[model samples]
Structure formats: C-alpha cells, structure tokens
Target: MLNLKQIVAGYGPAQVLHGVSLDVPRGRVSALLGANGAGKTTLMRVLAGLVRPQSGSVEHEGREITALPAPRRVGLGIAMSPEGRMVFPTLTVEENLQLGAIHARARRGYRERREEMYALFPRLAERRRQTAGSMSGGEQQMLAIARALMARPDVLLLDEPTLGLAPVMVKQIFEVVQRLKEGGLTMFIAEQNVRQTLEIADHAYVLENGRVQLEGSGAALINDAGVRRAYLGM
Candidate 1:
C-alpha cells in the first residue's frame, strides 16, 4: 500500500500541491481524476521520488520514503510510466525493456520476466528488434508500460497513459489496466478519461486546484451528480 499525507510540492516559488492526502490500498487500482494543472502529475512524481515534497510524507507499506531518490524508489517496487511515454527513440524494443531492469531484484530473472511482458503484449514481441521511435503512438505507449513492468514493481504509477491516443487505442490501454488489476497489481493512475477510468478503478479521487475535492468508491463517484455533470458530461 502507498500513502501520502499533507504533501506540498512546487517548482521554486510556484506551488502546485497544497495539503494533498490519499491512500492506495494493496492490490487495487486507485484513480486520480483531475483536469490539467490539478497537480495530478506532480503527485505522481512525488510518489516516484522524482520530486521531493516540501512538507508531509510518502510511505509505502509503512516505511517512510519521503527523502528517497528515484532509483531507490524503483528498488522499493515503485515504477512510473510517465505522461508522455518517454521511450528511447534509438533503442530497440527489447533494449528499452532491458533498461527497465535496473534494480537487482528485477534483473534476477530478467529473461523470464521479459517473456512475460512479451506474452502480455504480443505486439511488442513481434517488433522486438524495431526501434522505438519507428513505432506508432499506441505501440510506443504499450512499450512504455511494458518497460515499467520490466522493473517488476509492486505499485505502478501511470500518469495519463491514454493521453492523445486514438479512442480504440485508449480502450486497448484500459483493457490492459483491467487485466493488471485482475492480476492484483497495485496501481495509482492519474487520468483525465473519467468514465473509463472509474469503470476499471476500485477507488477514485478527484483533484481540483492541487487539492483533493472528492474521494470515494469508483462507482459512487461515477454516479455522483456533480461528477456526472462535470466529468461525464451528462
């Protein structure tokens, strides 16, 4: 499980998150829903240890990791697939995946784990030797998620995994998320596609202006009059 309490972070003088708090239960998908600039991405970065919080704390399974570095967080079973699907342009699909196994624990069974990833994403298997830059956006996004899985994380942080993808590709991505959830992966997804995200998420939190505005079960939030009106356009 992951927990954040009163996390305040910012870039220099421009503060983004203000007294944000949330919990991610083990083996469940927790969705963070917000429009742009709501500090969703910043929250993700804070969890991943990329951005040090100015106040409060981040804990995983009761261990404080507020000051831990990014690599150490990855070693602690935290892996993040960032917003833009930032795959290596010149690296082959296989190489990109291999890069994710930087931690010793992940590298122990690298080959077998990679095969599992390939099985989960057959398309990547087909283009194992292809350069990442040559792949389509959907393919690249798949590669991005696959690469993160290569770290063999216990909790995966996905920031806008479906951003800018085609509707069909978005559906495919969500299906993958659903499968991960079924397999008992603990995930914290920051997404804008409210309807689909709530469908697959166990719990949901709505962020507005860098703070939690609402938090509830996925279905409850989906059926909420305000959520329906603002996010679902109903």
Candidate 2:
C-alpha cells in the first residue's frame, strides 16, 4: 500500500538515507530492522512526511506524497507513533487520544473510536483521566499506540515501539501488533527487537548504513544463517 523508491534524505549536509527503497503491502506488517544509526527512523520520518527527501518518491496506493507535509500526510491516512513515544506528558490519557483525531476525517465517529481505543487498551480505559506523564513506561507505550490508532490511519508507522519496555511488556505490545495485523491494519514498523519483530511481521527488511541489505519473508529471515548469527545470536 506504501512504496518508497530510491529515497535519499538527511539533516542539512549530512545525508543519512542512501537510495533506500521498500514496499509495505496493504493489510500486512512490514518490519524494518537495523541497528542504531542504520537510518530506520529516518525512513519512517520520510514516510510520515516529517523529513523531506532530497530525492526519490513516497507513494501511497498509487499517488506521490513526497512533497506533502506532516499534517497533510496524517489527513491522507498516515499516522506515526514516534521513537520516543512522545506523548503529551501533562495531558490526560483521553486528552492525548483526542488530539490524534484532530483531522477532519478522523473526527467522524471520534467518540466511537475513543471507545474502541479504551477497549483495545483496558489500562488506558481505567486511567483515562490520569496524566500521561504519571503512567508507567508500558502504559505509556500502550497510550502511544492507542493514540495513533485513534486517527484511523490506513497505514501506521511505528518507530521503536518496544524500545525500553520490560520483556513482559514487549510481549504485550507485540500481541497488540498481532491483533492489529489480524484486524487488517497496514503497518510499517521500524524495530530493533529482531526475533519478536520477525515473528509478527509478514515481510522484513534489514537495513545497514542507510541501505537495504536484506529483504525476505519474515519466517525465512528468522531461519537465515546470516540473520541468525547477526541479529538472533544463534
């Protein structure tokens, strides 16, 4: 559903992505795997229209969106939960979620979507009035993802969604990812949790030095000799 072709992006003169290209199929989870500074997050930023690529194009469905701004991208069915779970700390959980539906399209049935989010994350339901800053790390992560889904995005961009959560919390978050996949939500996840990411992703790509070094079905990557040695430590 989303296609990025020969993308070259960076900060000022320091280029980070060097001709990166990938596809995210509709209703499937596509994992972008890489070590730190591999440009995974940069690619996500490009797709979300937060970073303008110097060259190459971002196409959703069949139209180019490379020139679109961040807010326009959100209106066009793209939403991102950034790397740090940048939730508004001072805002209540419900208020944070409400902000996600600010786009006119998402505003339709906003109340219903809020209820759905509460159902998806029962903890948030219980703490709807609690300040986001007061929530635990795991709860915060849930709130982050829940907030993104409130926009009813056609494709969700998740950058390091499980970054620093405990093992149990990581498992819980992945379960939610699985549930979203089952619900036919198209997602592009940039993650470092190799094993868990591959287990849940339909397809996966490994990035090295801002380039795609490997691409394959997630199960195949799981059993790949190189992937096992490098990522799985097997």
What's model 2's TM-score?
0.99
lDDT of 1 at 224: 99
For residue 51, model 2's alpha carbon misses the true position, in angstroms, by 0.4
Off by over 4 Å in 2: none
Model 1 clashing residue pairs (backbone): none
lDDT of 1 by residue, 1-234 (tens): 899999999899989999999999999999999888999999999999999999999998999989999999998899999999999999999999999997886999999999999998899999999999999999999999999999999999999999999999999999999999989999999998999999999999999999999999999999999999989999
* Residue-level lDDT tens digits of model 2 in 1-234: 899999999999999999999999999999999889999999999999999999999998889989999999898889999999999999999999999899987999999999999998999999999999999999999999999998999999999999999999999899999999999999999998999999999999999999999999999999999999999999
The lowest-lDDT stretch of 10 consecutive residues in candidate 2 is 68-77
**Which ranges in model 1 have alpha carbons more than 4 Å from their true place?**
none
